[model samples]
Target chain A: MSVINDLLGGFATALSLANLMYALIGCVLGTAIGVLPGIGPVAGVALLIPVTLNLEPTSAIIMLAAIFYGTQYGGTITSVLLNTPGESASAITTIDGYAMTKKGRAGAALTIAAYGSFVGGTAATVGLVVAAKPLGSLGLAVGPPEFFSMMVLGLALLVCLAGDSMTKALISGVIGLMIAMVGIDPVEGAPRFTFGNEFLLDGVSFVAVIVGLFGLSEILNTGTERPGKVETPGFRALLPNRTEFRRSNPAVARGTVVGFLLGLIPGMTGSVSALLSYGAEKRFSKYRDELGSGAIEGVAGPESANNAHANGALVPLFTLGIPASPTIAVLMGAFLQQGLTPGPSLFVDHSELAWGIIASLFIGNVILVILNVPLVRVWTSILSIPPAVLTALILVFMVVGSYTINFAAFDVFVMTLFGLVGLGLRKLDIPLAPLVLTLVLGPLMESKLRESLEISQGDFSIFASRPICVVLLLIALVIAATPLLRPRRRKTRSKENQHEAA
Target chain B: MHEQNQAAPPDRPSPPAGPGPTGPPGPAASSALAPLIGQAVLALVAAYVVFTSFGLGLWSHIGPGPGFFPLVLGVAMLLLALSWFVQERRRTATPAAAPAQGAATATEVPEVPVIPGIPSTPAAGTGDGSGGRGHVLAVVGSLIVLGLLIDLLGFQLTMFAFLLFHLKRQNAVRWITAVIISAVGSVGTFVLFGAGLGVQLPAAGIPFLANLGL
Candidate 1:
């Protein structure tokens, strides 16, 4: 009953003319950027942060959150029509979505994806409303020791899930932590790694690094690759047939559950959830044998999962101030930039803003389904623009975005430097997600650890003394050990098989 | 090691024999060399951090000081680097019997391509090849030039020139198309960000443009 009243209040704020306008604008821009290759949600959000600076906080966040999920809908169009995933989460959709397109069911695939996304996103929003207050209240009980341990666990999960190589992921994470330590020490006033440079005083701007790493570096990478031609498919009858609908309904339901559940776990997000859902469907579905060959369930399951995962990810951000993915990390930065710290106090201190954003998500998801279903042709046309012209336009935007942050050329230089570093890392196949996530979490972890030690009089046992802290630390330890043990266990099993054969 | 795997298609079977001299180095050699270089550099950086942290004082009366955390981070980094070094060495020493198994293992693990939102097909003709290297250098050089000249040449002229050069040289777009695109992109952004968003962009430093009222 309280949830209903709170949601009504939230609608009052979100349905206002200004917030709705921003939400619509975000949906349009997010779809536009998502349709383009090399510009994903992370870069799209980073590039738009500067544009949102002038708006009110609620409107700004409403638009930003809309963009984040809007990409999920937009990405599916490209995957179905172009066979190029607009983002990583949409990759699984391409295997069967594109197959459906090739078989002249592009319209059905696109329509089902949008519908699945709507279901997943709406369901997750409901989950968020029910789960957020309780989670935020739980966060209020977490002391510094528990917080520190939780952060460690978050980092561990991130490292475990990031890329193929745990070593590379750890290296990237450590490097991010090192970068975060560059500015003045939080406890003491001493500057750690500034090298006497004045620009380093405020530390490396997170937005600049993000734009460079995800945006500028991507442009450089695209420059090296030859562009592929895309054929725009006609949109006929934008509704799934009865048979397709029946087959898709169960997958969508399961994907929603899987996506929402995985989303609650810190560091697991759209890509992981989508892949896991696709794999699960492949293993268990009645259409399993036909999954990669234009099965509608293949398109339905992952699309739903990715959308649900996006909403699920917001749970940690709103309640505990922890970003579950790179996109959310940038969003968290935006929250901080807007003078809102996303934690337990956020619900009490800025209940209006919180509810406004949540309510806007519901409205935004509806807007996306309507917009994307009818405007599939418009988005497909966007892909017809020359890659060269698009690249130039993106560079201009990147430059302006960085410059507008402080109206300084120094930030542009920092952005350019990180761009080169990002290109190098991408070449080496190191995952950028962990780096960005850890960079955002590093300071929070440090401050919490410092406060915990102070409370315990420099005794290390405080972290182990608390039940939550102990459990969190144990989880972290298990996650850290899993990658190491798996190969050894496989080796032993293989050896035993050989012995039995002998 | 990661680089070599990224260079090849995920599902492509490894050759029975190692790569020849005319071809790029085999995965084993490249993997060993790259990690060796990366770990050595990381170790050196960690050592510097450790040395500086010691000077800053790792402990204080209240609790761990600023240096204490970095000190622990540095030591952990060094240990990780050392472990990576040992792993790469062992792999390189046993390459003859490992390449096929390595390929199988690589295929088993899902390699999410790095583009974040979009899962692109394996980039066409992109790797650590010289052509790719040249393209990267060209893009970086243009950005550096833009950063250096933005104030002096003014934002509009600098951006126009940078865009024109980047399109023509890096992307191989026709000169006419490049010119039109560059002009529109630079001027359009200036108006949107500078005028609409109220961001202050540098004005044209050229005397003729400044005296246009005449």
Candidate 2:
């Protein structure tokens, strides 16, 4: 009941004309970006961040929140139609999504994804609304050690989530952490790797890094490959049949729960939850043969999980000041831009603003579905466009987007430089996520570490002495150890076997 | 079981085969240099990070100074680079055996091994491989040219020229489509940064537009 009231309070603020309009624009633009291959929600959000600087803080936040959820909805269409996933979250969709497309059921797969995302996103937003207050309290208690441990765990998960070789993933993650070290040191106020360039003082902006890595590299790579040609499915074939719906219903439900839980944890990326949900669905599937054969459940499970996680991620960010993902770090930047501290006081001092953002999530999810469904064919048409042209547009957007950041050509130059480096990393098969997440968290981690030291009078044992920090550290150790020690492929195989048995 | 799986008749034809010189048909073969480039870039970036961290005087930070973690990160990065470099070297030196067996059965055997800098024609029919390495190099080269051209020609003219040229070169799309996409893309760029979002874009060549309150 209290959760419902709080959500209503949120709705009252979010529904205000200015905030609502921002949310609507965010949803519309975010979806367009999400439909394009090589353009993920993170880049879409980052690129748009500078533009939002002029808006009222709450409206900006609301718009950002809308973009985040909107991208989650938009990304699935391409994965289904073109086999070119718009975001990492949609990669799993490509398995069965492309299969369904091949079987002439692409429309159904897309529809399920759109609808499932709505349910999951809305459910997770409700969770966010309910837990906002307590979550903020929890955030206040997190010091440096806890933050550090959480990031370490996140890095471990990055390695685990990165495909194929664990060693490669670890190396990639370490490289990311290294990149995070480039700018001015958070605690010491000393420049690290600027090479005497003024831009290095602020470090490589996360927006520039993400755009270069995911957007530019994707363009460079996709240009090298033959882009898929997709034929749009008819409207009659868009909705799933009864049997298809029945199969996907349970998977979507499971995905929503899993994504919600994973999303609430600080530092866990949204893609992780979506991928994990997909993995779980495959492991528990009754129609095992349908696993990658255009299974409606495949599209439903991952899409729902991705959107759910996107919503769930806000719980930690809104309630706890700790950002759950890099995009959230950008959101935190927006809050800071407004002179708003995003800790416990955010909920207490700015209840309407906080709740409004939460409430808007529900409204956004509904709007995303409403906007995306009839536009399914439109999105598919957008996806079917040549990759070369699509990538060219991305290049233009990235250039303009970066330039908009500081209204300086310098930012664009930095974007291109990072983009070249990102292109090189893509060439070498290094994962870009760790580097990004680390960069986003670095300043905060440094600040918290310094605060902890000051409070504990420079005692290193303060990390272990704090119960929450100790537990978080242990969890990090476990997460790290599991990937290293566990026979990952064998575990997947055995899980497959169990599914076959069931 | 193999017979059961081979439900289709011989010469009933496979999906019009993918064109890449490396690997089997489809997307995996398409991603020939993706893994290679991704790894190398990561290594280079890591090296740069290490160099920067060293400049910060990694270990000599006074009580929780920014350089402290960076020092640890630098050492970690060096180790990571070394490991990555070794792995890439090993993979290149020893080509996997399975691909060799698969290659034996493929049609249109090349007279020479596919090497860097060699320009192979796009395989007939498939259109999947534009000898990707060449295209990758071409794009990079064009960008370099664009960079040089920017200060000389100014940002807008350079961007407009680059956009027009790259769009035309990359694919054989309709000239009208290309022109429209370029115009819309360029104009959208102007509107988004200049008018809509109210952020300034590079206005080197067109001083008039800059003065027009755009």
Model 1: lDDT to the true structure? 0.80
State the DockQ, from 0 to 1, for candidate 2.
0.17
Q: Taking the tens digit of each residue's C-alpha lDDT, what string does model 1 give over A1-502?
A: 8867888899999999999999999999988877776788888888899998888999999999988888889889888888777877887788899999888888899989999999999999999999878999999988989888877887888888776567777888888888788888888878888889888877888888888988887766656333356555555567778999999999999899999998888877587788889888988899899988999989999999999999998998889888888788889988988988998888899999999899999999999999998889888888777666677788888988887777678889889998877777765556777788878888888889989999999999998789999999999999999989976887798789999999
**Residue pairs in collision within model 1:** A86-B118, A87-B117, A87-B118, A88-B117, B1-B31
User: Top DockQ: which candidate number?
Assistant: 1
* TM-scores for every predicted model: 0.92, 0.80
**Which candidate leads the pack in lDDT?**
1
Candidate 1 CAPRI-style tier: acceptable
True contacts kept of each: 0.30, 0.23
Please give, for residues A122-175, the per-residue lDDT of candidate 2 as tens digits: 888778767876767776676667766666665565555553445656665555
Stretches of model 2 off by over 4 angstroms after superposition: A1-5, A98-105, A224-226, A266-272, A275-291, A325-345, A486-502, B1-62, B85-156, B174-177, B205-214
